[model samples]
Target: MARLDESARGVYLIAVTPFTETGALDLDGCDRMADFYLEAGATGLTLLGVMGEAPKLTTDESATIVNRVLKRVDGRVPIVVGVSSPGFAQMQALTGRVMDDGAAGVMIAPPGSLRTDDQIAGYYEQAAEMIGDVPFVLQDFPLTTGVQMSVPVIARIIKDIPTCVCLKHEDWPGLAKITALRKEGATARRVSILCGNGGVFLPEEMERGADGAMTGFAYPEMMTGVVENHAKGDMERARDLFDAYLPLARFEQQPGLGLAIRKYVLYRRGVLANPTLRKPGAALDPLSRAEVDRLMARLEKRLKELN
Candidate 1:
């Protein structure tokens, strides 16, 4: 059993929730994707993060995915469930629901459907009050949330809730501000700054002494190699792998094509049923499909070359 306070061991993969052709939750695909990451040697899984289509998923649906993932993993790895909503009450309720259903940790994005520091703080404050003893990882993806979680805001959260053990760092260069917050390395070990925004920024963040990342679902090798090997003085091979994967990783984060490309690649590789997602997720049109296919073909050829 994963205790709420159990320290995260290494870089975890943030899974992309898969769907079937008719927009049904692809439970089997979900299991296969999670298994792929674990077998690739990922430390744990940060489920329903920004990439899991959290904003688009219903609370009950999100809980169901977590429950299914829990069964599939069977305590082999910790599952950090993201249970965020627009308001504090909803966040608390969702957290309670997930915890009651047996999630290991509740990762929350900043307040949604609004844009103000006080509003954000109030949401989080109420969230802390509502969900005691639940471990929280503050998310800072402004693209997902309307506002950035500034240093002062984070400091406020830390002051109020010491159990907020991690901050999923997707802020552009917030690491610099974060590094400045170190009072005898308070920023380093006191709280974990998980590398979000894909593993692209991970090398730089690790170089600057940021903790591990909740990198993408498909490519656990990239983060695992960097953390376990590169961070541990195996720079030579790490550089080689990083160089080879840079293009593919860059393509993975391209606006609009992100999910479509990942699903297409997984489909081509025969791991996914199809390149499908829940509605309002913006699937590829003809032009977008052409772009995805081009990039995927390059990635596929490159993978074979590496072999």
Candidate 2:
């Protein structure tokens, strides 16, 4: 693989990995979702992300998904593959596969279960050194990852590996902290920061100086419009776009709703054969599906209002 195009534009959509009715990976569904986002102006595809149910996927499944997506994309858009697991060797192996498959970079969460600050830092330091020339985002998603990478840890990793690039900080107060870090008189060339919460807080993060969004653009109808319009210098339109999606976004916080709802919407949009989820992360049931339909109906009204 040659040098993939580096993401100069900071905003990215953490895409949902659609699945077939038979519980298989849905390549066609993934392609439609990618095209939807890219057409809406997303900068890149952040796949195998927590939003895409990375933890549930086996290492082989993860590698195959990356390869399939890379072949489908054919370099039209850069790929950001998230490798979050307790297994260091697994993370390293996934990173290698992603880099080899022409991904733009890898996003890594803290190592192992019950990782302390030092252990996390050490993991990042070692992982960066091992990854060599590839760029990776240090993703701090404590809600699921069981550990949060702190500011000092963030500072250390970037200082150690300039190629470490940036962070997908899921820490709430992180936006202000990152702003302070950048605004407080220190600078690094290769480092960048991105917003990771599903595009709901983009305006707020932008106000706090977030480099761009790393997640939540999967729904091309509303969220992607906000990120793209905002990037293109239309703040008013961005706010309107975000406001229109807030009612639906309210459910995005519900445990597992993000994936199930996203997959549901893809199914509705004819992007997926069916929303078949793996164990421990089952697809929306009748009740959940009903709620998704209601929310999407409201979202359709909102879309009409926008029009």
Candidate 3:
């Protein structure tokens, strides 16, 4: 098992699930993507995330994708599988299977139905019991999960659950949350904090004491480079590199349209064979495609200037 812990730090690319033009799972493309991420300086890889089109995959297909990716990666970096199911039964089953198949750990987001602090804390308590010693990342993106976890609430979870090792911190304007968590005596113990808003706030998050990123942006090299420079205390170079890709990253992170933009960029880069989403997923319009192309052009120019 990859078993992520507090000491873990650096870029963990939130992987996209590749598919054929007709919408079937692209197992071979999954292999290519794994290789591309590792070569681009990813310290780890997380799959079946929201950006991976996870909810769209059936159970069998999900297992197949995980198995394929793990095989291709072959333990070069930790592979964290997103096992956020509505039911603990399903979550437990998936976690067990993936761990058996060599995943390093799993990620869980609080159910959207959770509201009050107690409800949220209680839910994770049950989740911790169900998963039983399998390390997990607590995903804290209130925008998507609809369940906001206050700093105290998160501290409580960390205090109560020993296996909760990292956080996928995607709360917008979340720099303060990072600051709060890193404060002395906040959490019972230290846990790795990785922000995930498409790398939009990565520089600030890094400054606020985040470990690194676990977001899906087409140019993961940007995330890797920013984190590397930040670690080396080269703030100027980090900001410059982040700013160069900010335009494309902002364009690629348009909520409902973001995945289409990311997949297209990956396909255009030869990492994905075809930028096809599964059924019920949207495709980019010609106007959107044109917009992405223009952004990509600007990104190239800006990156050259930075260099």
Q: lDDT winner among the candidates? A: 3
Query: Stretches of candidate 3 above 4 Å error?
Result: none
Instruction: Judging by TM-score against the true structure, name the best candidate.
Output: 3
* Model 1 per-residue lDDT at 277: 74
**What are the per-residue Cα lDDT tens digits for candidate 2 across 89-163?**
777788888888788888877754645767877777777776677778878777776686666767777777667
Pairs that collide in candidate 3 are 2-104, 3-104
lDDT of 1 at 82: 84
Candidate 2 regions exceeding 4 Å error are 1-8, 112-116, 186-190
Go through the candidates in order and give the clash count of each.
0, 0, 2
lDDT of 3: 0.92
- Report the Cα lDDT for candidate 2: 0.72
The 10-residue segment of model 1 with minimum total lDDT is: 180-189
Decide which is better by lDDT, 2 or 3: 3
Q: Residues 33-52, candidate 3, lDDT per residue (tens digit)?
A: 99999999999999899999
- Which wins on TM-score, candidate 1 or candidate 3? 3
| lDDT of each candidate versus the true structure | 0.74, 0.72, 0.92
Candidate 1 colliding pairs: none
